[model samples]
Target: MTASHNWPPIDPADGWALILTELQRDLERIDPDLVMGQVKQKFGTLSVSAEASDPALADAVHGRIAAAEALSARICERCGQPGRIRQRPDGWYQALCNRHALEAASEMEGES
Candidate 1:
C-alpha cells in the first residue's frame, strides 16, 4: 500500500471522524430550514458551497473510501489473499477482491 505522504495534520485513522465533524458543522450552519425544504422539494440535498468546500474534506473522504478499498484489495474475503475492488452486479458498495466480489453480489442482492 502506498503511504499517503501528503496526509493532513490529523492521523490517518482519525481523519474521517474529524472531517465528518467539520462537514456536519458546515451543513448545520447552512440554514437547516432551507436544507430541509430543499430535501423535501428535490429529494436530494445541495452540494457544498465552493467557499465552504475544503480541499481537505475531499481528500479525507477519498482517502477513507480508498483505504477501505485498499484493505479489501489486500485481503480476500473468501480466498484470503490479495484482492481488488470489483464492481458488484447489484450495484452497491461491496469491498471485495475479484473472487469475493461475486460472493458479495449474492449476499448484497436486493439490499439498498
Candidate 2:
C-alpha cells in the first residue's frame, strides 16, 4: 500500500491540508471507490443535479485548483525569473525561462 508520507510535496500556504482532510472524512462516510466509479461512468455528461448549485462544493473545488496552479508557478529565487515546471519524457523536470522553453520546444521538433 502506498503511504501518505511518501506523497509529493505540497504548498503549505494553500490550505489544502484542511480541505483534503475534510474531503477524506466525507469519503470515508461513503465509499470513495463507488463515488469514483460513478464519476467515471458519467464522465463528460453534465447534468443539473440536486447539488449542482451547492456553493460550498463549488468553492472547495475552485480553491483547490487555484492553489495548485499558484504553487506550480515559480519565481526564480536567484535570478528573479518567473516560470513554471514542464514535464519531460526523460522523467526529469525542468524549470525553464520563457526564451529557453520556446527554444527547447523548437529543438525537440527539429529532432523529430
Candidate 3:
C-alpha cells in the first residue's frame, strides 16, 4: 500500500506534534497506501486512527501510536520541553516543564 496524504492537521506548539510527524513518516515506510483517518488530542493523550490492508501493517501503526503516547507524558503542554505530569487539587492534570510546574504549584498555593 502507498501512504495517503490525509494526515490530520496538528498544532506546532504542541510538544507531541513532532512525534506524530515521525509516526506519519514511519507509516509511509510501512505502507505507502495506508489511510490515516483521524488524529486528536484529549486529556493529555493522542489518538490516531489508521487503516491498512494487512494485519502486520496495522499492528505497526498501533505500535507507533503507543510509542507516541508514551513520549507525550514526558513533554510539557505549555512548552516543548522535558516535563512531568502534574495534577491540581481540583483534579486537573497537565504535563509541564519544571518552570511551569513550579508556577502552577505557586498559583494553587495562593488560592488557599
Steric overlap count per candidate = 1, 0, 5
lDDT of 2 by residue, 16-77 (tens): 33333443344333322212211110111111111212454554444443443343345221
User: How much does candidate 2 score in TM-score?
Assistant: 0.27
Q: Sorted by lDDT, highest first, which candidate order results? A: 3, 1, 2
lDDT of 1 at 23: 39
Which candidate gets the maximum lDDT versus the true structure?
3
Identify the runs in model 2 with alpha carbons over 4 angstroms from their true place.
1-53, 75-112
Q: Of the candidates numbered 2 and 3, which has the greater TM-score value?
A: 3
Q: Model 2, residue 63: what's the lDDT? A: 49
- Go through the candidates in order and give each one's C-alpha lDDT: 0.37, 0.36, 0.76
lDDT of 3 at 81: 87
